[model samples]
Target: MGLSFDYALLNLGRRPTRTVLTAVSSALVAALLVCTAAFVRGLEQSFTGAAQPDVALLLSRVAEGDVLRSSVQAGLGALVRANVPGVAVVSEEVHLACNVTVPGSDGARAAMVRGVTPAAYQVHDAVTLTEGTLPGPGEVLVGRLLARQMRVDPSRLAVGETLVLEGAKHRVSGHFAAPGTAIEAEMWTPLEALRGIARRPDASVVFARLEPGADARALQLFVDRRLDLELSLLTSEQYYADLARYLAPIRALAMAMAALIAGAAFLGGVNTAAAAVQDRIRELATLRALGFSTGALWRSLAQEAVLLGSFGALLGLAAARLFLDGGAVRLAMGAFTLGVDGPALALATVATLALALLGTLPALLRLHRLPIAAALAED
Candidate 1:
């Protein structure tokens, strides 16, 4: 008869300490894998999710695609709507970074701020005013992740609190959230109010939303025909895609860390498997003498490994769900929450089991050629 799973379970029970140790190691590795996947997934979502197919941008021809340094006439939005055929709405917007001070706070914190008219809400459809009304004159709407993004306390930007910007105090109107998009880290204000405060007479960029199935070429053609306007066009997809590439190094670093963690886990599994094999040399030989094949003993060892890994991976998943799931992390690109979703869990499980199986390789390699006669004669 072949070795059954019951035999494997019995072997594990005999070495309580060894089984617990290996299982614990597997759990730690699994938990870390979840964290890595969450970070990389969250970063990609923030960029890609912000890109909308129907939207495009107007920028100064000399500024390339960078909006921060771009400037155009203040009324470009209305001009585009009146001139372009396929355009449905055009929003005049200004994006800038400035220092904001909360009352009773020690120092000013720098944050990204956007100035926009009501049309901006339609162009950036991802944003939802979850907590408060749209911003009015001398008022600001903070994003849900603003506290983490700015590395400031959440209480500092609470509704009804006043924030000082450019020596002018503006009340926080409410909070908004755009899940999986970077806009959740920014604060928005009324277009005229912010323009007055910053003393900027021109719009930094024009955001245009084209009608469904609208020819995007109309936007390009409009800008192309008016070389005198010194304006260029870029799709929202193209801009956000470039931003994703610019941040690739961070993802690469996270994968590198994962590789290192995998290496450690593999080595640990191999060591545990080797020790168990060595300790059971005589018993394994006894089984061989009892008409059990070398293959059966090897399979029995693999089954034992699978059991330990499954238990450990499950424990790790539980701990991660409790502690790390939905947690937020800050980066230079603002903040993003951990994505402990199905894919991450699947990846962690597969990695753990695969490593467990591979860990049996060295010991299983020597099993077939084992000197059953000599092993059985041992004291």
Candidate 2:
């Protein structure tokens, strides 16, 4: 049978308010889906991108997965370098999660403070010295995205500004960037200075870079041989992978909210479609009596659903561009920007159309087997 959308197009005009409401409901669901997809994608990309395949962390197993709580002997780096054959360089780094204040700013903000040696530059090659100079005894250098991650004023972290940490003042020496990594939100200072500030002689961890093609199993074996060290070997990839799993609940929660809104949209679509059929029973019966095929009638209903879905998809994309795109979301590790890329947009659009198309099922079934004689005789 031939299909036509002329009657479907005209039907939408019969009750303009209902048509608008149905489209708006679909838009809300689509907007939630697009934003959730963007959030989940950005979160995974940032966490996974931060990992280095060959670098390993030597930390106390007691600290579990928290690097900030780890404590390894300061001399462990030297021992590892001497014992391990393929070890290129080892950096004894300290990680401190603490609050900091700007000299003139009133409130304090949380910051990730890392104490590093010059060898850290060799191990963490992803880091680059972008501006000013290396941090000296009483100064610190910040990452490029530190201000945004910390939600502080850019001037407060400028090259020449002073940052207060635990009642002590330290100058901001420079800002560096480690693209696609969580490292770009921390403040780095000299190891010796942080040792004095934190009043702990132990280093947080010994981050070691292995030579190309070297096995990380050797590092674990080294730890195994010396139970006295109490150090556990964790590769950078393993650390980030564990971090992503820990944060999985957050992504699930976002998708769950989107699913709830989608259910609401589906119900709205069904209500709208059922109402349209009920209002036009007599008119529809007349068409059936006049020789219009059941396939043509079903196609017309499908057309209306598609139109609503398409319009709503576009509206949702517009909402995502206005609100979620380029938006920063803060997490325990760091912050990442929500990106509404092509894949996210496409997925959300498809979901909207599918939900709309499925909603026509009940209405189509009723109209398909309608008793034309009774429908025409009714008031």
Candidate 3:
């Protein structure tokens, strides 16, 4: 039988307020889930890219979430280099989650600081010196984004421009960028600059870079043999994965919020669909009496729901991209940018369409069982 889609369209238009409410409800939920999912996934990317694949990290397995809390003697940095044949380079770097005040052209704001050795640039190849020079004792290299936020030029941040770190003033010597990671939002300094606060009697981790074809497992075993020192060995990838695991609690919380919001949306959608069908019962019954097949009626109802849901999905995704993109939030790893990637938009659309399918089911069944004679006789 030929379909009269116009009939369904006219019915939905007749009840404009209810239709609009349903659409708005679906849009709100889809937006929340999309933005939250993007932010959580973005945090993962920020930390993962910060880690170097060719590098192996040495830390205490007993240490908790903070790498700064993990301690390996400074001597081990040298020993790991000398003992491992495949190792090409090693450095003892210090990392802190503390905040610092930065002076920018726009004004001053608080941001995270990262202290690293000169070899940090070597291991993290993407860390390019964009301006001025490398950091020396009592000096720092601010990240490109952080420097911009602080309104200070790399070259202009003269040797005497005092940057207070945990109440101690350190000079700005250079500026750097880590391309696409959140590290670019932090300030870098010489490991010695944080001496008193970091209490680096021991280094946070002994970072070693391996030569090509060198098996990380073999190297891990080699370092694991030094369990007497209670040192745990891991490839940089493992360390990144561990960092993701460290942020699992926050991720879980994000997922929980998405679930709650999605659940409410689903329920609201069902109610809206049910109300749309109830209000149109007489018209639908008239169609049945006039010889429209139950299957045809089902198709029309499902099609309308899909159309409404698709509109809501598109609206939600657009909102996320326009409003939430590049939004930053603080996490244990550091502050990370919220990413609204293609996959996230696709997921949000699919999820909303699925909910539409669910909402359409009850309405379809209600129309199918109407008695043609009674439907036609009804006022």
lDDT, residue 371, candidate 1: 95
- Candidate 3 on 224-280: residue-level lDDT in tens? 687787877777777778877877888899888888877777776677767776766
Least accurate 10 contiguous residues by lDDT in model 2? 1-10
After superposing candidate 1, which stretches have Cα over 4 Å from the reference? none
User: TM-scores, in order shown?
Assistant: 0.96, 0.89, 0.84
What lDDT does each candidate get?
0.88, 0.85, 0.72
Index of the highest-lDDT prediction:
1
- Which has the better lDDT: candidate 1, or candidate 2? 1
Which is the better candidate, 1 or 3, if ranked by TM-score?
1
Task: Please give the distance, in angstroms, between residue 223's alpha carbon in candidate 3 and its true position after superposition.
Answer: 2.3
Number of clashes recorded per candidate: 0, 0, 4
Selected candidate, larger TM-score, 1 vs 2: 1
How do the residues 301-378 of candidate 1 rate in per-residue lDDT, one tens digit apiece?
889988999999999988888898877878764777787899989999899888888888887876787799998887
